[model samples]
Every structure is written in structure tokens, then in C-alpha cells.
Target: MERRKVDVAVIGTGTAGMVAYKAARKHTDNLVVIEGERYGTTCARVGCMPSKLLIAAAEVAHQVAGADMFGIHAEHVSIDGKAVMARVRRERDRFVGGVLETVDGFPAEHRLQGMARFIDDHRLMVDEKLEVEAGRIVIATGSRPNVPDFLQVAGDRLLVNDSVFELENLPDSVAVFGPGIIGLELGQALSRLGVRVRMFGVSGNLGGIRDDAIRQYALETFNQEFPLDPSAQVNRVERTDKGVRVTFTDKPKGKSPSEVSEDFDYLLAATGRRANVDHLDIQNTGIELDERGTPIFDHYTLRCSKDHIFIAGDANKDVPLLHEATDEGRIAGDNAGRYPDIRSGMRRAPLSVVFTDPQIAVMGLTLDQVKERCKGYYGVGEVSFEDQGRSRVIGKNRGLLKVYGERGSGLFLGAEMFGPAAEHIGHLLAWAAQKHMTVTEMLDMPFYHPMIEEGVRTALRDLNYKLNIDPQMIDRALECGPGA
Candidate 1:
């Protein structure tokens, strides 16, 4: 067997792994990155970029269909399934190609092509062909879609996000399971593309929104577009001669609910994901693991058990977003490269966004987190888009925004918003939270008229009053004018 030694070794070449490799390279010349499969990020290959491309197409179709609300008419707005999938695949390949180029540019000696398994804390065996001993190690193997075994009844008709983009043409009908971010985004997009979609979730959750009012509003709004059961009692999922058959009990709001049977061309599983550490045989490393079998690591430093081993990105399953993965990778790589002289990396404020029609976003602390951390000293401010001038003007008068602040200090704690332009608004609030700005201070920022941002100002004003930092708002005085 071939034997090799390096200062640092990184497993996986996805976003986190790639970033970790680069970060470690800055500290030492002896570094290697291992890949067992194709070299591309989950975002570029199956997670973010491709999914957004599909959603973009769906958004165009939806806007054209709803143009009549603006006194404009569009004729024969047809979506070609083959053409849609073709563009998605074609553009997706372009993104993946860029990642391949980056990986190719890495020094040949620093790239390994075999699967890596732990032999010990500082040792790894690659496909039983090579043995590697390193001073430090970083694990960024990322994650894969977690499909329940019961869904196997669909057999060949089942699909995950990885395979969904590979379809030649969109299916006529699909039964989507899980109402979290993935399920909600894909289900809504497919529905807009003229596919018969029925989404189901075991728990009454919508887009992972923590605020009750926003979750309820989102549930009602999405149900208007297609059938969705947040809490479904599925009896059986079986394969049919043509495709798949699902038996369930759906409880519709304000109606007699009973058993229902449905058939679809495919069963799309948007259920959560499992971190890829299971295949590494981490138990051999003597690292402490949680009940879920994941390594116990420090969030700030990304250290697993000691200074020599680290875990980052979805492998840790702390924050699964791409940006968080990138940051964690940098921290882990930097610490691994520096080893005994480890230092904590800068951790940013919490922020999450779901790119649905109305958009769902949360910044800094969530309502639950604030309640727990601040006890009974936090106040909430809210604004509804139903009558907001800009929202009414744009025909996007749906959803709500709630901002939280501390009662004593009037410091902005966090926010949960299910409303228009939330993706952008979430960023602004995140900046404020990171800077630890007060509610009155955020309200002091300029507010432009007839824009979605004005809605944010309204919520801050309400929060200011609730925190006793300002007086109550006057009736109808907040809005500028008709459709302003």
C-alpha cells in the first residue's frame, strides 16, 4: 500500500471542503483534499443554484398568469415541460463546470480521488489502497437527502432533489412530502408550472417559520394555490401499475375531513438530510459523539475533540446554509493548519431565508430564542401587508412582519417575517442585530416612500412604542397616501 504524510488533510471537496482547503493552504504547504465522487457543490449541483433556476421559471409563469390583476392580459401562457427541464439542466451544468475548474486548478499532489475512512484521529485509509497520516484533519463531507424507507414503496417512481433536475420532462402529477423549505419551494414551483401537486407534512410546520401567526398565514396563502396538508395522517404508500398510490386522511379547515386516496406519477421526498459522517467510521477515531452519532464540536472554533481534528458545514448539522458552511470551513481549516495555537473564528449573526413567492426570512434570534434568552423583557412589533401602501400597489398584499426588541434597553433582538421583499429586509435586520442597534436607532434610519422597506420602518415604529421608547402610532398616519 502507498503511504503518505501531510500536515493537514481535508475530506470532501464541496463548498465547505474547498474553502477549508484554501484557508489551510494559507498557513502551510502540506495539505490535501479528498473526494470520493464528482467535484461540485450541493448548491451548484442540486441544492441552491439549480433550484433557484427552476423557481425563476415558475415565477415568470405565475406573473404572466396573474397579469390580469394589473389590468394587463397575457394569452396562451404555456409552460413546456421539456424546455423548462432542458434549461434547468443546461444552466446547472454551467455552474457545476465552474466548480470543476476550481478543483482542477489545485496542485495535483494535493488532490486524492478515493473515499477516506478514519483509521485513527490523525490517520486515514483511502479505499484500502493508500494510508495517510496527518498532523491535523478537517471533515467537511457535507450531507445527502434523507429519504424514509416507507417511501421505497414508490420504487423507481421516487425522486429527490438530486434526481428531480435530471428529469427529461416534468411529471404530470407529483406527491410531495415535507412542508419545510425544500418541499414548499419545489411544490409551489411545480404547481405554477401546471403540474398537479399535493404536499404533505407530518407536523404542522410551514417553511420552518417559528412565529405562529406567520406560519398560519403562510399555510392559508399556499393552500390557495394548491392542496397542502401540514399535518397529514398517511396510512400507506404503495406502488401502482403506473406510478405511486398514497392513502391519507386530510383535515381541511372548516370542513368534514376524512380518508383520501391519491395517485401521482412520482413521489418527491423533500424530507430532511443526513450528515455524511456515518460512512467514515468515526467511532474508530475516539472522538466524542452526540446521541445522533455526530461529533461533539465547539461552534466557535469547529474543533471536534482536540486541536488536531475539526468538523464543519452540514457535517456538523449546526447551520446548513451555504454561507455558514463557508465560514465554518474557514474556521476549521485555519484551526487545523495552526493546530496547537488555535483561535476562535468570528461567528456572524443568525440569518435564514426561504425564496418562496411571498418569501420567508428570519434574522438574529428567533422569537423562541429571544423569549428564552431575555425572559419576559422582550416586546414584539408587527405590520401586515394587507393594507400597506406599497404592498397594495404591487398586488403583493399578503403576509406579515414581526420585529422583536428588549423592553429595558430597546435593543433589537430579532425578527421573523413572512412577507414581500423579506429576503432583502432580512439582511437589513441582520446588520442591525449584528451591530446591536437599538429599536429607536433602527427607526431613525431614512425611510423612502412607496417601497417595501417602508414596511420595515412601520414595524420598527410599532416595536419602539411597545418597548416604551416612543409613543403609540396615530390612526392612518403611518401610510403616506393612496397606494403610496
Candidate 2:
């Protein structure tokens, strides 16, 4: 077998693996990155960029449909599914091209295109053709859409994140199988794009929002966009000449859930994802694996069983967002570079956002996590978009925001919101939480008039009152700033 030695070897040239390679390059001149899939990262290829392209087309169609509400009437607002899909693929190919360019820039010998498996703690077999002997190895094999066994009957009609963007034409009707992030975003987008969409969610909360008020708002608002059943148990799928048929039953307790059948031109499975480690034969490397066959590693340092092995990205199942994957990869690379004297660093305060109208964004602690981790007193401050001036002005006043903080110290703990530009608000709360800033301190900051940020200030104000801090404290806190 062809054999080679390197200071570090990175598997899977996705975001995490690419970042790991770049990071390790700083500490060691000898490094290699291997992949057997398309070079572009998930975000650029399917998960984020292409989906957004579809969402963009959808949002335009929706806006045109809603134009009459503002006294601006629109006529003949028609869409060509083929044209819309062509633009999405065209733009998607451009993004993928950039990733390919980067991959091509790597040294010819350092880039290996083959499946890799651990032969031992210190060696790997690539494509059963070459042996890689390395001082350290980083695993960033990433993940794939979780398609269940039953859906296989649909065969070519089934669409997952990987295959959805490849559609040459938008289906006339779609039955989204999950009501989580992908389901809601694409389902709503598809419905707006003049497609009949029926969404299924096995849980009450859509878009994975845990806050009760926001979840309620999400449900009510989403219902207006598309039909949804949050309590569904998919029985099976059957192939048909036109497309496929799905059988499911409502699972709500005491409701006498009935079996329901639906036929659609396409089915999108946004169920979830599993780490791509099933083929790795990790047992040979002696790294402890979880039930999912994902390697168990230090969440902070990304180190695995041996000093030479590190796991990052979705492979570790710590944080799966693209940005977090990149950070985890950097941590893994840095640790592998340092070898036995590995260092550790904590991740940023949690930030998650789902791109939908009145988008859902969550930051820092959830109520459950707070109750379990912080035994100390905590309070929630909430506001409705109906009362917000900017939301009303924009004619989109429909959602809620809830901010949680320590009742005694008034320190900001976390926030969950379903409102316009909630993504920006989530970042603000995450930044404040990262600094351990309190309610009064957050309120001390300036809030512009007739802006969505005022909504955030309003929540902070409610929190200030809940903490029983004096109203005068705002002035005193503000006095420390310029022009006070």
C-alpha cells in the first residue's frame, strides 16, 4: 500500500475539516485534508445558501401577494417554477465553484479523495489504496439528512437537504415530513411560492422554539401560511405514478387521533441528521463512541481518546451550526497542533435562528436549562409585537419576545423571540449574555425611537421592574455614558 507520513491529517473537507486544516497549518507545515464528497461546505452547498435562494424567491412571491394590503395593487403576479429553480441552481453552482477553487489550491499530494477509516490509533486507510501515518488526526466528516427506512419506497420522489436544491422544477404540491427548522422555513417558502404545502410535526412546538408564548405565536402565524399538524405519527409511504402517498395519524392524547392520508407531488424529509461515522470503523482507533457511532470527545478542546485524535463539527454532536462547526474545528486543530499539551476554550453563548417571516431566534439559556443549571431565582420579561410601533408601521405586528434574567441580580440570562428581525435581536442578547450583562446595564444602552430594538428595550425595562431595581437606576447607569 502507498504510505505517507504527515504532522496532521484532516478528514472530510467540509467547513470544519477545511478550517481545521488551515488552523493546523499555522503550527505544522506537514498536513493533509481528505474528502470523498463534494468540496463545498454544507452551508454553501445546501443547508444555508441554496435554501435561502429558494426562500428569496418565495418571499418575493409572498410580498407580491400581500402588496394589496398596502393600497398598492399587483396584477398578474405569476411565477415560472422552472425559471425560479434555474436561478437557485445557477447561484448555488457559483457558491460551489468558489469552494472547488479553494480545494484545487491545495498541494496535489496533500489532498486525497477517498473514504478514510481508522486502522489504528495512529494510522488510516484511504479508499483501501493508501495508508496515512500521522502524528495527529482531525475528524470532521460532517452529517447527512436523516432519511428513514420507510421513505425509501418513494425512491426518486423523496427530497432531502442534499437533493432538494437539485430540483429542475418546483413541485406543484409538497408534504413536508417534519415541522422543525427545515420543514417550517421551506414549507412556508414553498406555500408562498404558489405550491400546496401540508406540514407535519410530531411535537407541539414548530421551528424548535421552546418558549410557550413565542411557540404559540409561531403556530398561529404559520397556520396562516400553510396547513400544519403538529401531532403526527407517519405510518408509511407508498410509491405512485404521479408521486407518492403518505399515511399518518394525529397523536394528540385524548383526541381520538385518526389515520389521515395525503398525496403530494413531492416529499421533503427534514427529520434530522446523523453524524457520518458509520463507515469509519472507529473501534479500530479505540476512540469511545456514543450510541450513534459518533466519537466521544472533549467538548471544549475537541480531543478524543488519544492525544493524536480530535473530533470536531457535527461529528462530535456538541454544536452543529456552521459557525460553531468552524470554531470547533479551530479548537480541534489547535489542540492537535499542540499534541500532548492540549489547551481548552469554551464556546460562545448559544445563538440559533430560523429564517422565516417573523423569524425565530433563541439565545443563551432555555427555561429548562436554566431551571436545571441555575437553582437561583430567575424571571421572564415579555412583550407583544402588536404593541410595538415599528412592527405596526411595517404592517407585520404579529409575534412575541421573552427575555429571561436573574430576578435578584437583574443579570440577563437568555431570550427567545418570534418577531421581525429577531435574528438581530438574538445576537444582541447573546452578546450581552456573553458579557454577563444585567437587565439594568442592558437598558442603560441607547434605544432608537420607532425601531425594533425598542422592543428589546421594553423587555429589558420589564425585567428591570421585575428585579425591583429602582427606576432612578437607569439614569445613574446612563450617566456613566457620554453626553449624559
Instruction: Please give the CA lDDT of all the candidate structures.
Output: 0.90, 0.84
lDDT of 2 by residue, 170-275 (tens): 8899888888888888888889888899888776658888977678778879887787877767887898999989888854547887888889999899988888
lDDT of 2: 0.84
lDDT of 1 by residue, 147-223 (tens): 99999789899999989999999899999999999999999999999999999998888898999889989989998
Q: Candidate 2: which stretches are off by over 4 Å?
A: 250-258, 468-484
For each candidate, what TM-score against the reference? 0.96, 0.94
Our tally of clashes for model 2 stands at 0
lDDT score, candidate 1: 0.90
Model 1, C-alpha of 345: deviation from truth (Å): 0.7
What are the root-mean-square deviations of the candidates from the true structure over C-alphas?
A: 5.4, 4.1
- Top lDDT hit: 1
